[model samples]
Target chain A: MLIWRKTMEMIPGGTLITATPEEGRQLAMTMARKSIGAIQPEAEVRKALPPKYANSPDSLTAAAQVVALEFATIAAANKYWRKNS
Target chain B: MLIWRKTMEMIPGGTLITATPEEGRQLAMTMARKSIGAIQPEAEVRKALPPKYANSPDSLTAAAQVVALEFATIAAANKYWRKNS
Candidate 1:
Protein backbone atom coordinates (compact mmCIF):
# COMPACT_ATOMS: atom_id res chain seq x y z
CA MET A 1 0.00 0.00 0.00
CA LEU A 2 1.55 3.28 -1.12
CA ILE A 3 0.85 6.41 0.85
CA TRP A 4 0.85 9.56 -1.21
CA ARG A 5 2.62 12.52 0.41
CA LYS A 6 2.76 16.23 -0.22
CA THR A 7 6.23 16.65 -1.70
CA MET A 8 6.37 20.04 -3.36
CA GLU A 9 4.45 23.27 -3.06
CA MET A 10 4.40 25.93 -5.72
CA ILE A 11 5.42 29.50 -4.85
CA PRO A 12 3.69 32.80 -5.74
CA GLY A 13 0.44 30.92 -5.22
CA GLY A 14 0.22 28.61 -2.21
CA THR A 15 -1.17 25.55 -4.02
CA LEU A 16 0.14 22.09 -3.25
CA ILE A 17 0.11 18.57 -4.70
CA THR A 18 0.01 15.35 -2.75
CA ALA A 19 0.93 12.30 -4.82
CA THR A 20 1.80 8.66 -4.63
CA PRO A 21 5.32 7.94 -5.82
CA GLU A 22 3.96 7.20 -9.26
CA GLU A 23 1.87 10.32 -9.41
CA GLY A 24 4.58 12.48 -7.87
CA ARG A 25 6.95 11.39 -10.62
CA GLN A 26 4.63 12.33 -13.44
CA LEU A 27 4.27 15.76 -11.92
CA ALA A 28 8.03 16.15 -11.54
CA MET A 29 8.62 15.23 -15.18
CA THR A 30 6.16 17.84 -16.28
CA MET A 31 7.84 20.59 -14.22
CA ALA A 32 11.34 19.75 -15.39
CA ARG A 33 10.40 19.84 -19.05
CA LYS A 34 12.76 21.83 -21.30
CA SER A 35 14.65 23.42 -18.40
CA ILE A 36 18.39 23.85 -18.61
CA GLY A 37 20.18 20.50 -18.48
CA ALA A 38 16.78 18.99 -19.17
CA ILE A 39 16.61 15.68 -20.96
CA GLN A 40 16.85 16.12 -24.70
CA PRO A 41 13.61 14.46 -25.75
CA GLU A 42 11.19 11.99 -24.26
CA ALA A 43 10.85 10.20 -27.59
CA GLU A 44 14.63 9.80 -27.77
CA VAL A 45 14.90 8.66 -24.15
CA ARG A 46 11.84 6.42 -24.22
CA LYS A 47 13.98 3.30 -24.18
CA ALA A 48 15.98 4.50 -21.18
CA LEU A 49 12.93 5.23 -19.02
CA PRO A 50 11.47 1.76 -18.76
CA PRO A 51 14.14 -0.75 -17.74
CA LYS A 52 15.76 1.44 -15.06
CA TYR A 53 12.50 2.66 -13.59
CA ALA A 54 11.68 1.91 -9.94
CA ASN A 55 15.03 0.41 -9.10
CA SER A 56 15.36 2.16 -5.72
CA PRO A 57 12.71 4.33 -4.12
CA ASP A 58 14.34 4.91 -0.77
CA SER A 59 17.69 5.69 -2.35
CA LEU A 60 16.09 8.19 -4.67
CA THR A 61 14.38 9.92 -1.78
CA ALA A 62 17.64 10.07 0.12
CA ALA A 63 19.41 11.44 -2.91
CA ALA A 64 16.82 14.17 -3.29
CA GLN A 65 17.40 15.26 0.28
CA VAL A 66 21.14 15.49 -0.21
CA VAL A 67 20.79 17.30 -3.51
CA ALA A 68 18.34 19.77 -2.06
CA LEU A 69 20.75 20.62 0.72
CA GLU A 70 23.61 20.99 -1.69
CA PHE A 71 21.61 23.26 -3.94
CA ALA A 72 20.53 25.38 -1.00
CA THR A 73 24.11 25.68 0.17
CA ILE A 74 25.26 26.77 -3.24
CA ALA A 75 22.48 29.28 -3.57
CA ALA A 76 23.47 30.63 -0.19
CA ALA A 77 27.02 31.15 -1.39
CA ASN A 78 26.00 33.52 -4.13
CA LYS A 79 25.37 36.22 -1.55
CA TYR A 80 28.86 37.43 -0.76
CA TRP A 81 31.73 39.55 -2.08
CA ARG A 82 29.91 40.63 -5.22
CA LYS A 83 32.29 43.48 -5.92
CA ASN A 84 35.33 41.27 -5.46
CA SER A 85 34.00 38.20 -7.31
CA MET B 1 26.30 43.64 -11.35
CA LEU B 2 24.79 40.17 -11.15
CA ILE B 3 22.82 38.50 -13.89
CA TRP B 4 19.52 37.04 -12.79
CA ARG B 5 18.08 33.84 -14.20
CA LYS B 6 14.87 31.82 -14.13
CA THR B 7 15.51 28.66 -12.15
CA MET B 8 12.13 27.27 -11.16
CA GLU B 9 8.47 27.75 -11.98
CA MET B 10 5.67 26.97 -9.57
CA ILE B 11 3.26 24.33 -10.81
CA PRO B 12 -0.56 24.51 -10.99
CA GLY B 13 0.37 28.11 -11.68
CA GLY B 14 2.92 29.17 -14.27
CA THR B 15 4.34 32.02 -12.23
CA LEU B 16 8.14 32.27 -11.93
CA ILE B 17 10.81 34.20 -10.05
CA THR B 18 13.91 35.45 -11.80
CA ALA B 19 16.74 35.97 -9.36
CA THR B 20 20.35 36.97 -9.11
CA PRO B 21 22.59 34.76 -7.00
CA GLU B 22 21.86 36.61 -3.78
CA GLU B 23 18.15 36.71 -4.46
CA GLY B 24 17.96 33.09 -5.55
CA ARG B 25 19.47 31.88 -2.28
CA GLN B 26 16.66 33.57 -0.39
CA LEU B 27 14.09 31.83 -2.59
CA ALA B 28 15.65 28.39 -2.30
CA MET B 29 15.84 28.79 1.46
CA THR B 30 12.17 29.61 1.64
CA MET B 31 11.09 26.55 -0.38
CA ALA B 32 13.28 24.11 1.50
CA ARG B 33 11.72 25.22 4.76
CA LYS B 34 10.11 22.48 6.86
CA SER B 35 10.67 19.96 4.08
CA ILE B 36 11.57 16.42 5.04
CA GLY B 37 15.22 16.34 6.06
CA ALA B 38 14.98 20.08 6.02
CA ILE B 39 17.30 22.09 8.18
CA GLN B 40 15.74 22.53 11.56
CA PRO B 41 15.35 25.98 13.09
CA GLU B 42 17.14 28.42 10.84
CA ALA B 43 18.32 30.30 13.91
CA GLU B 44 20.23 27.30 15.21
CA VAL B 45 21.76 26.85 11.78
CA ARG B 46 22.08 30.52 10.96
CA LYS B 47 25.80 30.36 11.56
CA ALA B 48 26.08 27.46 9.13
CA LEU B 49 24.20 29.23 6.34
CA PRO B 50 26.24 32.39 6.53
CA PRO B 51 29.88 31.25 6.46
CA LYS B 52 29.36 28.59 3.80
CA TYR B 53 27.14 30.79 1.69
CA ALA B 54 28.11 31.84 -1.87
CA ASN B 55 31.07 29.55 -2.12
CA SER B 56 30.84 28.71 -5.84
CA PRO B 57 28.32 29.80 -8.49
CA ASP B 58 29.50 27.78 -11.47
CA SER B 59 29.76 24.63 -9.45
CA LEU B 60 26.32 25.19 -7.96
CA THR B 61 24.85 25.65 -11.40
CA ALA B 62 26.53 22.47 -12.61
CA ALA B 63 25.44 20.61 -9.50
CA ALA B 64 21.87 21.72 -10.05
CA GLN B 65 22.01 20.34 -13.57
CA VAL B 66 23.21 16.92 -12.51
CA VAL B 67 20.79 16.88 -9.58
CA ALA B 68 17.90 17.82 -11.85
CA LEU B 69 18.66 14.93 -14.15
CA GLU B 70 18.99 12.54 -11.25
CA PHE B 71 15.66 13.71 -9.83
CA ALA B 72 13.89 13.31 -13.15
CA THR B 73 15.33 9.82 -13.46
CA ILE B 74 14.01 8.93 -10.04
CA ALA B 75 10.60 10.36 -10.88
CA ALA B 76 10.60 8.32 -14.05
CA ALA B 77 11.26 5.23 -11.94
CA ASN B 78 8.07 5.58 -9.91
CA LYS B 79 6.16 4.94 -13.10
CA TYR B 80 7.21 1.31 -12.93
CA TRP B 81 7.03 -1.50 -10.30
CA ARG B 82 3.54 -0.76 -9.03
CA LYS B 83 2.69 -4.48 -9.06
CA ASN B 84 6.10 -5.69 -7.89
CA SER B 85 7.18 -2.99 -5.41
Candidate 2:
Protein backbone atom coordinates (compact mmCIF):
# COMPACT_ATOMS: atom_id res chain seq x y z
CA MET A 1 0.00 0.00 0.00
CA LEU A 2 1.47 3.31 -1.09
CA ILE A 3 0.99 5.70 1.79
CA TRP A 4 1.32 9.35 0.73
CA ARG A 5 2.11 10.70 4.16
CA LYS A 6 5.86 10.51 4.00
CA THR A 7 6.42 12.20 0.66
CA MET A 8 6.19 15.88 1.63
CA GLU A 9 7.24 17.56 4.82
CA MET A 10 6.23 21.16 5.46
CA ILE A 11 9.16 23.50 5.67
CA PRO A 12 8.92 26.73 7.57
CA GLY A 13 9.34 30.07 5.76
CA GLY A 14 8.20 31.16 2.30
CA THR A 15 10.35 32.79 -0.33
CA LEU A 16 7.83 35.10 -1.96
CA ILE A 17 6.13 37.95 -0.12
CA THR A 18 2.97 39.19 -1.77
CA ALA A 19 0.98 42.39 -1.73
CA THR A 20 -2.06 40.72 -0.21
CA PRO A 21 -3.52 37.42 0.94
CA GLU A 22 -5.63 37.15 -2.19
CA GLU A 23 -2.55 37.52 -4.31
CA GLY A 24 -0.86 34.85 -2.31
CA ARG A 25 -3.87 32.57 -2.64
CA GLN A 26 -3.99 32.97 -6.38
CA LEU A 27 -0.26 32.43 -6.70
CA ALA A 28 -0.47 29.30 -4.58
CA MET A 29 -3.21 27.89 -6.80
CA THR A 30 -1.33 28.76 -9.90
CA MET A 31 1.75 27.02 -8.57
CA ALA A 32 -0.30 23.96 -7.72
CA ARG A 33 -1.82 23.84 -11.20
CA LYS A 34 1.53 24.40 -12.81
CA SER A 35 3.02 21.58 -10.76
CA ILE A 36 0.30 19.31 -12.06
CA GLY A 37 1.12 20.33 -15.57
CA ALA A 38 4.75 19.46 -14.96
CA ILE A 39 3.83 15.94 -13.94
CA GLN A 40 1.32 15.42 -16.71
CA PRO A 41 1.87 17.68 -19.68
CA GLU A 42 -1.19 16.49 -21.55
CA ALA A 43 -4.23 18.46 -20.47
CA GLU A 44 -6.68 15.97 -22.01
CA VAL A 45 -5.21 13.14 -19.97
CA ARG A 46 -5.32 15.20 -16.79
CA LYS A 47 -8.95 16.03 -17.55
CA ALA A 48 -9.85 12.34 -17.71
CA LEU A 49 -8.27 11.35 -14.42
CA PRO A 50 -9.91 13.45 -11.65
CA PRO A 51 -13.09 11.44 -11.33
CA LYS A 52 -11.16 8.43 -10.14
CA TYR A 53 -10.34 10.10 -6.85
CA ALA A 54 -12.54 13.16 -6.75
CA ASN A 55 -14.71 11.83 -3.99
CA SER A 56 -12.14 9.90 -2.10
CA PRO A 57 -11.98 11.46 1.32
CA ASP A 58 -8.42 10.43 1.95
CA SER A 59 -7.29 11.96 -1.31
CA LEU A 60 -9.22 15.14 -0.69
CA THR A 61 -7.77 15.52 2.77
CA ALA A 62 -4.31 14.96 1.47
CA ALA A 63 -4.89 17.49 -1.27
CA ALA A 64 -6.23 20.05 1.13
CA GLN A 65 -3.20 19.58 3.31
CA VAL A 66 -1.02 20.23 0.33
CA VAL A 67 -2.78 23.50 -0.48
CA ALA A 68 -2.95 24.50 3.12
CA LEU A 69 0.71 23.91 3.46
CA GLU A 70 1.41 26.02 0.43
CA PHE A 71 -0.89 28.74 1.62
CA ALA A 72 0.68 28.74 5.01
CA THR A 73 4.06 29.11 3.45
CA ILE A 74 2.82 32.07 1.46
CA ALA A 75 1.20 33.59 4.50
CA ALA A 76 4.33 33.19 6.53
CA ALA A 77 6.35 34.74 3.75
CA ASN A 78 4.05 37.74 3.74
CA LYS A 79 4.38 38.04 7.53
CA TYR A 80 0.97 36.71 8.29
CA TRP A 81 -0.93 38.68 5.63
CA ARG A 82 0.97 41.91 6.04
CA LYS A 83 0.37 43.91 2.88
CA ASN A 84 3.39 45.08 0.92
CA SER A 85 3.33 48.89 0.86
CA MET B 1 1.31 41.58 -12.38
CA LEU B 2 1.36 38.53 -10.14
CA ILE B 3 4.86 37.24 -10.52
CA TRP B 4 4.81 33.56 -9.59
CA ARG B 5 8.32 33.47 -8.32
CA LYS B 6 9.33 33.32 -4.64
CA THR B 7 6.21 31.68 -3.25
CA MET B 8 7.78 28.27 -2.61
CA GLU B 9 11.23 27.52 -1.40
CA MET B 10 12.67 24.03 -1.94
CA ILE B 11 12.91 22.17 1.31
CA PRO B 12 15.48 19.47 1.79
CA GLY B 13 14.60 15.91 2.85
CA GLY B 14 11.52 13.89 2.02
CA THR B 15 9.50 12.13 4.66
CA LEU B 16 8.38 9.21 2.56
CA ILE B 17 10.71 6.46 1.46
CA THR B 18 9.46 4.37 -1.44
CA ALA B 19 10.39 0.99 -2.86
CA THR B 20 11.24 2.44 -6.22
CA PRO B 21 11.48 5.61 -8.25
CA GLU B 22 8.33 4.69 -10.12
CA GLU B 23 6.38 4.49 -6.90
CA GLY B 24 7.73 7.83 -5.79
CA ARG B 25 6.85 9.34 -9.15
CA GLN B 26 3.28 8.10 -8.99
CA LEU B 27 2.87 9.38 -5.45
CA ALA B 28 4.25 12.76 -6.51
CA MET B 29 1.76 13.01 -9.34
CA THR B 30 -1.08 11.90 -7.12
CA MET B 31 -0.17 14.54 -4.57
CA ALA B 32 -0.05 17.15 -7.29
CA ARG B 33 -3.51 16.19 -8.55
CA LYS B 34 -4.93 16.12 -5.08
CA SER B 35 -3.55 19.59 -4.41
CA ILE B 36 -5.28 20.86 -7.51
CA GLY B 37 -8.49 19.33 -6.33
CA ALA B 38 -8.09 21.08 -3.03
CA ILE B 39 -7.75 24.44 -4.76
CA GLN B 40 -10.49 23.82 -7.30
CA PRO B 41 -12.86 21.11 -6.18
CA GLU B 42 -14.99 21.31 -9.27
CA ALA B 43 -13.72 18.83 -11.81
CA GLU B 44 -15.38 20.67 -14.69
CA VAL B 45 -13.65 23.91 -13.85
CA ARG B 46 -10.26 22.26 -13.67
CA LYS B 47 -10.89 20.55 -16.98
CA ALA B 48 -11.75 23.83 -18.63
CA LEU B 49 -8.80 25.83 -17.36
CA PRO B 50 -5.86 23.83 -18.65
CA PRO B 51 -5.97 25.01 -22.24
CA LYS B 52 -5.57 28.63 -21.25
CA TYR B 53 -2.02 28.10 -19.98
CA ALA B 54 -1.03 24.76 -21.42
CA ASN B 55 1.28 26.33 -23.96
CA SER B 56 2.63 29.15 -21.81
CA PRO B 57 6.37 28.60 -21.41
CA ASP B 58 6.64 30.43 -18.11
CA SER B 59 3.85 28.41 -16.57
CA LEU B 60 5.30 25.19 -17.90
CA THR B 61 8.72 26.02 -16.60
CA ALA B 62 7.33 26.92 -13.22
CA ALA B 63 5.33 23.71 -13.20
CA ALA B 64 8.32 21.64 -14.16
CA GLN B 65 10.36 23.29 -11.42
CA VAL B 66 7.68 22.37 -8.93
CA VAL B 67 7.73 18.75 -9.99
CA ALA B 68 11.50 18.68 -10.16
CA LEU B 69 11.74 20.05 -6.65
CA GLU B 70 9.31 17.36 -5.49
CA PHE B 71 11.15 14.56 -7.27
CA ALA B 72 14.42 15.74 -5.84
CA THR B 73 13.00 15.61 -2.35
CA ILE B 74 11.67 12.11 -2.94
CA ALA B 75 14.94 10.95 -4.41
CA ALA B 76 16.85 12.34 -1.48
CA ALA B 77 14.51 10.56 0.90
CA ASN B 78 15.09 7.26 -0.88
CA LYS B 79 18.82 7.81 -0.46
CA TYR B 80 19.52 8.34 -4.11
CA TRP B 81 17.39 5.49 -5.47
CA ARG B 82 18.52 2.79 -3.10
CA LYS B 83 15.91 0.03 -3.05
CA ASN B 84 14.48 -1.02 0.24
CA SER B 85 15.29 -4.62 0.91
Candidate 3:
Protein backbone atom coordinates (compact mmCIF):
# COMPACT_ATOMS: atom_id res chain seq x y z
CA MET A 1 0.00 0.00 0.00
CA LEU A 2 3.00 2.32 -0.20
CA ILE A 3 2.27 5.28 -2.44
CA TRP A 4 4.23 8.48 -3.04
CA ARG A 5 1.35 9.88 -5.08
CA LYS A 6 -1.90 8.63 -6.49
CA THR A 7 -0.06 7.93 -9.74
CA MET A 8 2.43 5.49 -8.26
CA GLU A 9 2.61 1.76 -8.81
CA MET A 10 3.04 -0.47 -5.80
CA ILE A 11 6.18 -2.49 -6.53
CA PRO A 12 4.77 -5.56 -4.77
CA GLY A 13 6.78 -6.02 -1.58
CA GLY A 14 9.53 -3.60 -2.57
CA THR A 15 8.80 0.11 -3.08
CA LEU A 16 5.92 2.16 -4.32
CA ILE A 17 7.28 4.30 -7.14
CA THR A 18 6.07 7.54 -8.61
CA ALA A 19 7.54 9.29 -11.62
CA THR A 20 6.92 12.27 -13.81
CA PRO A 21 5.89 11.75 -17.40
CA GLU A 22 9.50 12.32 -18.37
CA GLU A 23 10.99 10.05 -15.72
CA GLY A 24 8.54 7.28 -16.57
CA ARG A 25 9.57 7.47 -20.19
CA GLN A 26 13.19 7.24 -19.20
CA LEU A 27 12.45 4.30 -16.93
CA ALA A 28 10.77 2.35 -19.69
CA MET A 29 13.62 2.99 -22.09
CA THR A 30 16.47 2.24 -19.74
CA MET A 31 14.89 -0.35 -17.45
CA ALA A 32 16.92 -3.13 -19.01
CA ARG A 33 20.04 -0.99 -19.27
CA LYS A 34 20.50 -0.08 -15.58
CA SER A 35 21.03 3.53 -16.55
CA ILE A 36 19.16 4.94 -13.55
CA GLY A 37 19.29 4.01 -9.91
CA ALA A 38 15.55 4.25 -9.34
CA ILE A 39 14.85 1.56 -11.91
CA GLN A 40 15.41 -1.97 -10.59
CA PRO A 41 16.22 -5.05 -12.56
CA GLU A 42 13.20 -7.05 -13.70
CA ALA A 43 14.74 -10.12 -12.10
CA GLU A 44 15.35 -8.41 -8.79
CA VAL A 45 11.85 -7.09 -8.63
CA ARG A 46 10.47 -10.40 -9.80
CA LYS A 47 12.21 -12.34 -7.07
CA ALA A 48 10.46 -10.43 -4.33
CA LEU A 49 7.06 -10.05 -5.99
CA PRO A 50 3.81 -11.27 -4.50
CA PRO A 51 2.12 -14.25 -6.07
CA LYS A 52 -0.01 -12.02 -8.29
CA TYR A 53 3.03 -10.69 -10.13
CA ALA A 54 5.44 -13.58 -9.77
CA ASN A 55 3.29 -15.60 -12.16
CA SER A 56 3.35 -13.20 -15.07
CA PRO A 57 5.11 -14.29 -18.23
CA ASP A 58 7.15 -11.12 -18.27
CA SER A 59 7.38 -8.84 -15.29
CA LEU A 60 8.48 -5.86 -17.31
CA THR A 61 5.53 -6.22 -19.64
CA ALA A 62 3.19 -6.71 -16.72
CA ALA A 63 4.74 -3.74 -14.99
CA ALA A 64 4.25 -1.60 -18.05
CA GLN A 65 0.62 -2.62 -18.13
CA VAL A 66 0.15 -1.81 -14.47
CA VAL A 67 2.07 1.47 -14.68
CA ALA A 68 0.09 2.64 -17.69
CA LEU A 69 -3.08 2.65 -15.62
CA GLU A 70 -1.64 5.14 -13.18
CA PHE A 71 -0.74 7.40 -16.05
CA ALA A 72 -4.22 7.13 -17.55
CA THR A 73 -5.86 7.73 -14.19
CA ILE A 74 -4.04 11.02 -13.85
CA ALA A 75 -4.85 12.01 -17.40
CA ALA A 76 -8.53 11.33 -16.90
CA ALA A 77 -8.78 13.07 -13.54
CA ASN A 78 -7.22 16.24 -14.90
CA LYS A 79 -9.59 16.21 -17.86
CA TYR A 80 -12.44 16.21 -15.37
CA TRP A 81 -10.96 19.05 -13.37
CA ARG A 82 -10.21 21.24 -16.37
CA LYS A 83 -13.77 20.77 -17.80
CA ASN A 84 -13.13 22.15 -21.28
CA SER A 85 -10.19 20.06 -22.50
CA MET B 1 0.78 14.62 -33.95
CA LEU B 2 -2.91 14.27 -33.31
CA ILE B 3 -3.74 14.73 -29.63
CA TRP B 4 -6.71 15.05 -27.32
CA ARG B 5 -6.58 17.06 -24.08
CA LYS B 6 -2.80 16.67 -24.01
CA THR B 7 -3.44 13.23 -22.58
CA MET B 8 -4.10 11.06 -25.55
CA GLU B 9 -2.05 8.81 -27.79
CA MET B 10 -2.04 9.70 -31.47
CA ILE B 11 -3.79 6.92 -33.38
CA PRO B 12 -1.55 7.41 -36.35
CA GLY B 13 -4.03 9.52 -38.39
CA GLY B 14 -7.33 8.76 -36.79
CA THR B 15 -9.19 10.86 -34.21
CA LEU B 16 -8.14 12.63 -31.04
CA ILE B 17 -9.97 11.07 -28.13
CA THR B 18 -10.30 11.57 -24.39
CA ALA B 19 -11.88 9.54 -21.63
CA THR B 20 -12.49 9.52 -17.92
CA PRO B 21 -10.49 7.37 -15.54
CA GLU B 22 -13.28 4.82 -15.47
CA GLU B 23 -13.67 4.79 -19.21
CA GLY B 24 -9.96 4.33 -19.72
CA ARG B 25 -10.02 1.34 -17.44
CA GLN B 26 -12.88 -0.15 -19.39
CA LEU B 27 -11.09 0.47 -22.64
CA ALA B 28 -8.06 -1.38 -21.38
CA MET B 29 -9.98 -4.34 -20.07
CA THR B 30 -12.49 -4.86 -22.86
CA MET B 31 -10.16 -3.84 -25.66
CA ALA B 32 -9.99 -7.37 -26.95
CA ARG B 33 -13.62 -8.16 -26.35
CA LYS B 34 -15.34 -5.61 -28.63
CA SER B 35 -17.60 -4.83 -25.71
CA ILE B 36 -17.57 -1.12 -26.50
CA GLY B 37 -17.84 0.70 -29.79
CA ALA B 38 -14.85 2.96 -29.21
CA ILE B 39 -12.39 0.12 -28.94
CA GLN B 40 -11.29 -0.93 -32.38
CA PRO B 41 -9.78 -4.06 -33.77
CA GLU B 42 -6.02 -3.95 -33.38
CA ALA B 43 -5.54 -5.13 -36.92
CA GLU B 44 -7.72 -2.38 -38.35
CA VAL B 45 -5.81 0.32 -36.55
CA ARG B 46 -2.58 -1.34 -37.49
CA LYS B 47 -3.43 -1.04 -41.16
CA ALA B 48 -3.82 2.73 -40.89
CA LEU B 49 -0.72 3.33 -38.83
CA PRO B 50 2.32 5.23 -39.96
CA PRO B 51 5.53 3.44 -40.90
CA LYS B 52 6.79 3.66 -37.35
CA TYR B 53 3.94 1.65 -35.82
CA ALA B 54 3.52 -0.74 -38.71
CA ASN B 55 6.90 -2.12 -37.74
CA SER B 56 6.37 -2.66 -34.05
CA PRO B 57 6.53 -6.06 -32.42
CA ASP B 58 3.19 -5.38 -30.79
CA SER B 59 1.21 -2.20 -31.35
CA LEU B 60 -0.93 -2.67 -28.27
CA THR B 61 2.17 -3.01 -26.15
CA ALA B 62 3.70 0.00 -27.86
CA ALA B 63 0.50 1.94 -27.37
CA ALA B 64 0.35 1.20 -23.65
CA GLN B 65 3.86 2.59 -23.38
CA VAL B 66 2.99 5.81 -25.19
CA VAL B 67 -0.36 6.45 -23.51
CA ALA B 68 1.24 6.16 -20.06
CA LEU B 69 3.08 9.45 -20.46
CA GLU B 70 -0.11 11.43 -20.81
CA PHE B 71 -1.40 9.85 -17.62
CA ALA B 72 1.83 10.59 -15.78
CA THR B 73 1.87 14.15 -17.09
CA ILE B 74 -1.59 14.80 -15.79
CA ALA B 75 -0.66 13.10 -12.54
CA ALA B 76 2.54 15.11 -12.10
CA ALA B 77 0.95 18.39 -13.15
CA ASN B 78 -1.78 17.97 -10.59
CA LYS B 79 0.78 17.07 -7.96
CA TYR B 80 2.65 20.26 -8.77
CA TRP B 81 -0.55 22.24 -8.50
CA ARG B 82 -1.64 20.62 -5.23
CA LYS B 83 1.90 20.99 -3.75
CA ASN B 84 1.17 18.77 -0.76
CA SER B 85 1.10 15.33 -2.32
Mind giving the per-residue lDDT tens digits that candidate 3 earns over B1-85? 3322321333322322222332232223223122212334345554565544322223334344433444344334334222222
Q: Rate the local accuracy (lDDT) of all candidates.
A: 0.31, 0.48, 0.33
Residues A1-85 of candidate 2 have per-residue lDDT tens digits of: 2222321312213446666545655566655545544544555654667564554334444444445456556655655442232
Poorest stretch of ten by lDDT in candidate 3 chain A: A1-10
Error of 1 at A30 (Å): 26
lDDT of 2: 0.48
**Ranking by TM-score, best first?**
2, 3, 1
Q: How do the residues B1-85 of candidate 1 rate in per-residue lDDT, one tens digit apiece?
A: 0011233332112111212333333333333232212212233333444443236565355445444433333222222224434
lDDT of 2 at B34: 41
- What order do you get sorting by lDDT, best first? 2, 3, 1
Candidate 3 per-residue lDDT over residues A22-69, each given as its tens digit = 543443343212211112223453344356633555745745563555
Clashing pairs in 2: A6-B16, A16-B6
- Which residue pairs of candidate 3 clash? A71-B71
Lowest lDDT 10-residue stretch of candidate 2 chain B: B1-10
TM-score of 3: 0.24
Model 1 residue A21 distance off true place after TM-score fit, in angstroms: 3.5
Better of 1 and 2 by TM-score: 2
RMSD of each: 19.6, 16.3, 14.4
